[model samples]
Target: MDVLSDVMTVLRTGRPFAARFAKSGPWSDHRIGRPNGFGVQLMVRGTAVAVTEGGETYKLGPGDALLVPHGAAHLVADSPDTPPGPRCEPGHAFPGAVLRSDDPEATHVILCLAYELAPNRNHPLIATLPDFVHIPADPGERPGLAGAIAMLDGELASEQRGGDTLVPALLDAVLMYLLRALLGPRTVECRFAGWATALADKAVGPALEAIHAAPARQWTVASLGEVAGLSRSAFAKRFTELVGQPPLAYLTSWRLTMAARLLADTEAPLASIARQVGYGSEFAFAAAFKRDFGTPPGQFRKQAPACDPGAEPFRREAVAV
Candidate 1:
């Protein structure tokens, strides 16, 4: 699998939640906050404005999309001056709620999707992103994104058979498109060295895939350089420049991340977990784990909450329109 897909597999938890808002006339503002995850907003029609908690305002037009990666509390409104309505309780929505303006000419429609990530595990790629990633509407933009939005709109508008199974899958596709759009070559001028740059780099991308594909392998600078088709020194410099860390340092972080996942999700013994994460012995792995996580592996596991692998996906929730 590619680097983005692998990262999603490791970091994402539960299915995504989606809601649609259809309104005519002036609409009361809605505040959305996702403490445990992130929120994505798409303008399907008309116009709207999003005000971050920090007082930054972003105007969104039809076809525009925004990613609130930090889940900051924000206000969505038809205009900047619109007053916010009562706070919508979590997982509850008023039946037949629709916002109407005094003027008959105003109309707006929007779609919001929420994705839950592993709360305890903070992926480096996610950390590098800004508070928001905005993709403006463009007539010549990638058609796949528009098509996905259209399909999602259709699914929500009609009572089609198998929609329960299909909507979640479509939301997942929308997320992939959003990430791909954000990481596209056009955004290569990003200020910081992060996953977007690392994934796009010719040399670092392959090396990253290699490291992820074989976390248990006894890889060194030379081996990784061979994978990247670079000399050892060149590979180390480029990897560190684009990924914000030296190759070996990144490898250790990834290994420990995998070990933590195994500790939480599986019943494997500590020695096996150590071997799987490339440690030579239980003692060495425990030492590293303690240093990195500030807790021993056994205690970490004991304190971990029970994980329900078969938990239901995507509890539907909506905001008052």
Candidate 2:
């Protein structure tokens, strides 16, 4: 699998949720958040302003999308001066309910998609991202979002055969298209570097894919360089410059992350887990795990929270909206 898809698969902690919301009149709403989740809000119609708790403000219009990878708290309103309205918490919204205002005139529509991610594991690829990724509909930058939104709304309303399975897949596709544009060659966000640049680089991209594909492989700097089709020293320099870590250092960190996920989500024995992450023995793996996680593997598993995807509804969390 590719780097983004692999990380997304390992990070998911619960099922995906999709909903469409309609609001009218002058309004401001602070939406609730999922503890370990990623959220994407696409402006379907009308205009609004987004104010993050960090004081970052965004003006949004039709076809624009905001991606909250770590569930940052934010408020959306008809205008910045609009009085902050009631908090938009869960259950306050029904499948197709209209969030009305003082006067039911002028409608603003938005499509919301959320993905529950694991709290225990943190991938550097995701860690390097900013709090929000805004893919504005800068003319040709993002196309066909309206069509995707219509399909999503229809799939949910119809609930025909296989809708349950199809809805999630559609949700994933919608997000993928938005993100694919984010990683496009023409993405000109000057502030985005590190992992984003490395992911798009021809040399570094292949090396990352190799590491994720086979974490247990006995990889040396020279071997990884060969995989990247670059000389050893050149690859080493470029990888560190773009990725912000030496190749082996990144490998060790990723190995520990994958090990932690296995510890929390699976019941495999310690020895088996050790070998899977490239440790020659259980004792060595335990030491590395403890160093990174501040707890031994056995204890971490014992203290692991209920991470089952069907465990329960999302707990309330906010960043500052």
- On lDDT, the leading prediction is 1
TM per prediction: 0.84, 0.82
Model 1 steric clash pairs: 25-101, 26-101
Q: Summarize candidate 2's per-residue lDDT along 1-321 as a digit string, tens digits.
A: 777776776677545656555667587888665556677887877988888887799888888888888777788888899988777643323321212212124477666677766677666666777888888875454555556666775664333566556666677778777767676653254246787778778898889889989999989999999999999999999999988999999999888877877887889999999999999999999999999889999998888653344344332221222
* Best-fitting candidate, scored by TM-score: 1
Candidate 1, 1-321: lDDT as tens digits = 667777876666555556677777466556567665677888988998888878899999988998888676788888888887555322224211211112224387787776666677677788888888788876467788888888887676544577667777777788888787778753364444576788777788889989998988999999999999999999999998878889999999889887877887789999999999999999999999999889999998887543332345344333334
Each candidate's clash count: 2, 2
Q: Report how far residue 222 has shifted in candidate 1, in Å.
A: 1.6
Error of 2 at 321 (Å): 20
- lDDT (CA) per prediction: 0.75, 0.73
